[model samples]
Structures are given as structure tokens and as C-alpha cells.
Target: MATSVGDTLEDDVVAIPWTSFCDKAFNCLVKHKHDAAGSSLRIYASDFIRVYEEILDQDLLLERCKELNPDLEVTAAYLSEHLSQGITKALKQTCTAATQEACMKIVTCNAGLLVMQLHTMISGVPFLWEFRMPAQTASDAFYRHVTLPMIVMIVGLQKQQEDLFALLNDKDSEISDYKRSGQHLSRKHLETKVFDAGRFRRETLTPKHLKDCLSNVHLNPFGSEAGLMYRKMMEAYKDITTSAREPETRSPKNHSSSNIPVEVVKETRETTTAMDVTRLEEEPKPHKVKKAKKRMRL
Candidate 1:
């Protein structure tokens, strides 16, 4: 009698040995259930089921089993164990082609419920197995999908932080340059220096001293003598103006006429024409010469 499609696939699947993987997967699932809380267990179980379903192919399983034991009608539990063993053996032989092919077939052939249960068992298998070795020993698709993105995000954030630090450093340097250009000290450096509050008080309280201090502070130390002289003159004028505003000083109109010095008024005019007087004094006076008359008796 010709074997049915399901029987044939099942026999073929059973022929492939996967005992080690099945035992490992079962133990892992039991441990997972034992360690996890009720809520967590549900989540982990669901994930495991999904992975198991994806690794076990029903159609190929039935076909393979039918080829293996055509005369014997296998029960559901037997079929399940047989498929599990086959997948485990396939993963052991070569996790690259065989495992992937088996997983793909399972996912395609099984219904949603069966797929979930199968994947639960398959995912429980250890990464490094004593019996079966993985084909591609490097990272898997799961690592790329899950672990790699997380790593990339962390590295990206670190780079951004470094860039922010660099930007802050650049800004600080620019600020320092601006302060130097403006004839001002850096705030950071200023904080480290000792300040004389008394000096600041003395300078600010007096307008003359304030002007002098401001000039000295603002002007370049290498400025021309003329600039220094101008600053001095300004300070002198401010002092005079400030002195005149004192409470004890009398107004100009209230001053007595006797307070004006006669010599001061006269000397002011003399000094005004002193240059011309000197020029006149330096000129030579004309001499009167006596001439002798010659004989004009004719």
C-alpha cells in the first residue's frame, strides 16, 4: 500500500535522529518554568513555543516518518518526539543548511498552535551543544535583530556625549579669546586670583580715581604717551569738577571782590603779549649820524 503524504513525511522526519536536542529542549523548558514567575513564564513559554514551531516541519515530518516506518501508525506524542529528534540531529549535523531548512519547513507546514509549541522546544536548545555543532559559529540573525541594535544605540549616545563635550570646550576657548580682545580678564582665571576690595572701593567711590582706573584698565599698556597724557588730563578735570561740587565751598557769586588778586589779573595780560614784547626789545635802534658840509662858497 502506498504511504499517505502525512505518513510519508512523518516517517522521513523520524528517520532523522534528534534525541539529544529533544532532551536538552525539554530540560531547558522545565528549568525556565521553574525559575520564572507566573507572568514571566507565560511570556517565555510563548516565545519558546514560537521558536519550536518554526523549527519543526509537519509535512516533511510526516513524509519522512512514513518512509521510516510505513507499517506502524505513530501516535501524536511519538510523532512529536520523532520530529524533535530529527531537528536536533539536523542542528547537530550542520546548523547552517540542515537546521535552517528544517526550521523553515516546520514553520511553513504547521498551524499557528503547533508552530508555537514547536518553537518553544527548539529555542530551549543550548547555543553550544555537546552532540551537534552550529554551522555558522559567529553571530546569528537574532543577535543582529536584537543585540546589535542595542549596542549601536549605546555607542551612538556615547559619541554624541563626546561631541557635546568638545563643543563646550570650543565655546569656552572662544569666550576666553573674546575677553582678551575686549581688554578683560577671563572669569575662570579671575576666580583663582586674589582681589583687593579696598582698591576697588577707593577707585569707585571717587570720580577722579574711577576715571583713572577705567583708563588704565582699558588702555593698552603699550599705548602712546599722548594717550596717557589725555587720560591724566581727563582725570584732573574730573577732580576739579568734583571738588567744586563740595558742600562747604561757596558759590562763585557769593565770593568777595577782594578775593581776586591784582597781580594775577595783570600778569595774565603781560604773559599774553610777552612774545611780541621780546621781539620789540630784540630790534636795533636807529643811529643819528652828523655829516660835515663841504665848501659851497661860490
Candidate 2:
């Protein structure tokens, strides 16, 4: 069994043993049926790897890691080396694809749980689920790898179509502080910086800067296209916020509003009036005695 440097072996380690623990855990999941085809250890490994990869690909894992160690430089290289290595090792041991997939899921879940447990132990914070990297580094990574180049390409295309729109819009300017030198800056570079700075500001500083950067009204064709994308992104953010704030249970008044209460009230009143008229008709009416008097006179 591979062990880390700081970890001390407990007495249980010697007596109960890792092998026994694994066997028990595996058996607990899949009853101790000895058939190799039915329940293999590799299944767990594969499941664990799949989950681990998914988490790694998402921003949540890096965010969680940052929460744990704020100063740690969590580069893509570091992730591939340390975390991915552990996952690969676990996966490689599995003999079958099905077994491997199962194990990957288990390992990923276990890893996340372990991180949470570790954070709790270290910081006494129960909900430290995501890790965050340094603001500047994270911004750089996001722009360089994801949004930066795209924005740069957009700006470049816009510049070719319209000269007036060449200037960085209000939204871009607010997110980024310009370092003016004698040399002119390229459209691509400016756009890249804008996107990166915007993301950085969102994560670390206030998002108010984003409004300023986006406020420039001069629309090139490319700018208009980008604006639509930006709006969609904002909508998604709004939806997330709305979902979080939405009440779990609605009020009785709200529930009743779905039915046509005004119509119901009108129907009720009409029914009452009709019943009253029917009751009046059912009552005996007084008969005139004129006909009997006339007969007596004749």
C-alpha cells in the first residue's frame, strides 16, 4: 500500500488492514458473491475515474482547492500531475471496462468526500466544498484557455468591418486597466485582456465593472453578435440567482389565484339567486275568491 509522508499508521491499520477494509467495503456494496463476472473491484475504479475527470474539468474542483489552500498555484499541469495521476493509477488496476467505469465513479466520489473532510478538519468550515485559485492566476487561465482568445477573435473581426467600433467598448474598459506605452496595442491583445480582467473582477472584485465595460453602444457587426452572447450569459446568471431565491412553498392565496376566482364568485352568486326564486315558487300562493262570489250572485 502506498502511503503519504505525514500519515501515521494506526493500530487498526495493522490489525484490520487496508485489504480487509477494501474487501468489506466492496462486499457491502455488492454482496460477497464470489463470481468474478458479477462484481469486480475494477468496476468501482472506473466509476471513480469518470467522476474524477468530470470534477477536474469543471471550475468547482479548482475553486474548492483554492478554498483549502489559497496560496497554492493550481495550474493545469499540477492537476494533471497529482490528481489525475492518482485517478489513472486507480483505473489502470481494473481488468474490465465495466469494472473500471464503476471504480472510477467510486474514487471520484470518495475524493470529493475526502477533500471536504480534510477541509473540515483543517479549517473547521463544514461547507468548504469548492476550491478557489488566486484571482489573477485564475483570470489568466480562464482568458488564455477559454474566453480570451474567443474575445480577441471577435474584436479583430469587428475592427475589420467598422473602424468606429475599433475602440474598446465601455464594458471592456471597465474590466481592464490600460497600460499605455509608446507602442500601439493590437485589437486581439486588448480583447483578451478585457475578457480576462472581466472574469477576474467578477470572481475577486466587484462585478460593477462589467456593466461599464459593456456599456459602449457603438455596435459593429461582430460587437452585436458578441452582445447577444453576453446577454445569454447574463440570462443564465439571472436564472441561477432566481432559482436560489425562489420560495419552496407558495402561499394559499397564490395557489388559489390559478383558478378563476372571479368567475367562481359570479357562479356562486347566480346559484344562490336561482335557489331563492325556486324556494318562492314552491311556497303556496293565495287564491282569489271572486269566482265563487259571482256564482252565488247568478
Candidate 3:
């Protein structure tokens, strides 16, 4: 059950009816029944304990803090007990089915406030977590959770990009070999242009492309016509490659030498050469032959 508070004068106190609260809640829930779910963080109640424990590990906290102050008053046992109690209380508070839904709203509405809210919920004391953390511990946690991990991810992504570029170069070489062998694509539009990474990145990172990505966040990528066509094309390519891997088996009766008759080919070439020679000779001798005919006539 949820409750709402109403405001009034200092001396006057007014209580809103429970029915009004229920009505408002129902309407609000229905309005966003079909949330877009783009760029939103979702954490289920069932996984709350694991999520909470991941950040609040007692040994890790103690080790990180101990480096700053060797005489630190907080012990591992105390930290563990404190975390256990807070987690239990937080779980009890968010045991309801709608807790996950409320989390989604909070995450999308004001993500910055989420950390504070979680601190309050887990500690059962507002802002207590802030004062407890020293500068050293806070920095270490930030580096571990945010900075270092991000650096690692960037490095991995760069390596993957290099691999992809190498693969594209190999494909370009294959296409060049085909061109050199006098093979042509059946469709002129199918010919690919040389790739320019800078231009491609500039074109892909446009505001319109960002909007398209956001708009498609909730769509099923594999449900589109382009996806179906891509699947069919891959299937055909796979079949062609599979067939190419197998050795050709030719029949003994159908020899390569018998494919064309040698005499017919020779005669055709001779006839073509003779026709060309006759035309060239006639062109040069036409005036001479005409003069000779006039002399004979005279």
C-alpha cells in the first residue's frame, strides 16, 4: 500500500481520502503501461541482495579504508553486521511486486538521486553513508567501479575495431582478385566502394541516426524485412562456400578435348581472316583497277 501527503495552513490539517491516492496511482501506472525501455536501468527485487552485496563487500571496504588509516576504528565484523542489517531492512521495505516498477521510474527520473536513495534505504538513516566514507576509500571505489573498468572497455573496443578493419582489408583484397579475373557482379549496384573510416564515423554519428537508434530501442531488430533479406543472403553465401569446398567429379565420357571440334574452329578463324584481307586489299586497289578499265576501254 502507498500513501500521499497533502498540504494546508499551519493550524489546519487536512487528510486526503485513500480512494484519491489509489485513483492517482492507478492512472499514473496505466499512462506508462507501455514504457519505451530505452536507456533505462532495471533491477529486480530478487536480485537486490546480490546487487547490494556487490558494492558493500565488507572485506573490500575494510581493505580499501585501512590503507588510508591503519588505526581505522571500523572492523570487518562490524561492517558485515551493519551491511547485513541494512540489506535485510531494505529488502523488507521493497518486498512488494511494484518495487521494480518504482525503481525504473526513479532511475529514469533522476539517476543522480538513486545513490542517495539507496543509501538511505539500506542504512535506514538518511545521508549516513556520505559522512562515513573518507576521501581515500571513495577515490578507490570510484576508480575500481568506474574509471579503471571504462579504460579497460575502451582498450578492448579499440582492439576489436582493429580486427574488424583488418577483416575489411582482406575482403577488399578478395574483391580485387575477382575484378582481376574478369568476374563482374550481376548487379552494378552491388559493387562496393572503398571504405573511409572517418567519413563513415561522421555519417553514422549524426543526430538523425541517434534519434533512429533511440526510436528503434523497443523494436525487434530481427522482425524487419531487411533482417529477413540479410538472413537469406547469408544462407546463400554459406551454401555457395560449402559447395566450393567439395572437389569436382567429372564423367570420363565427357572429356574436355571433345567439348569443341578442332576442324570447325580452325575453318571459322581462316574464313574470318580471309574476309578481312579481301576488304583491305579491295580498298587500296579500287582507283588503280578503275584506271586500268578506262585504258582498256580506250
The order of the candidates by lDDT, greatest first, is: 3, 1, 2
What TM-score would every model get versus the actual structure? 0.18, 0.18, 0.31
lDDT string for model 3 (1-298, tens) is 1110110001000100000001111111000000112211111110111111023344564664355334333545443443333332332333244442111112121212222123322112121231121122222323322232233334444555777877887898899999999999999999998776787779878988788656733232222343333333323322332333346554545333231223322222111000000000111111111223222110
Question: After superposing candidate 3, which stretches have Cα over 4 Å from the reference?
Answer: 1-136, 211-298
Clashing pairs in 3: none
Whole-model lDDT values for every prediction = 0.29, 0.27, 0.30
Compose the digit string of candidate 2's lDDT tens values, residues 243-273: 3335656566654422222322222211100
TM-score of decoy 2: 0.18
Which 10 residues in a row give candidate 2 its minimum summed lDDT?
Answer: 271-280
Q: Where is model 2 more than 4 Å wrong at Cα?
A: 1-24, 27-54, 90-298
Error of 1 at 231 (Å): 65
So what's the TM-score on candidate 3?
A: 0.31
Q: Which stretches of candidate 1 lie over 4 Å from their true place?
A: 1-139, 183-298
The TM-score-based order of candidates, best leading, equals: 3, 1, 2
Candidate 1 per-residue lDDT over residues 1-298, each given as its tens digit: 3222122112111111111122222311110111011111111111222212123234443454455434333333334443434333342332333343233111221213322122212222211111111121222322312222223334444455566666766766776677679856545455332234465457658977567656633122213343233233323322332333346477666533222233322222211000100000111221232222521110
Better of 1 and 3 by TM-score: 3
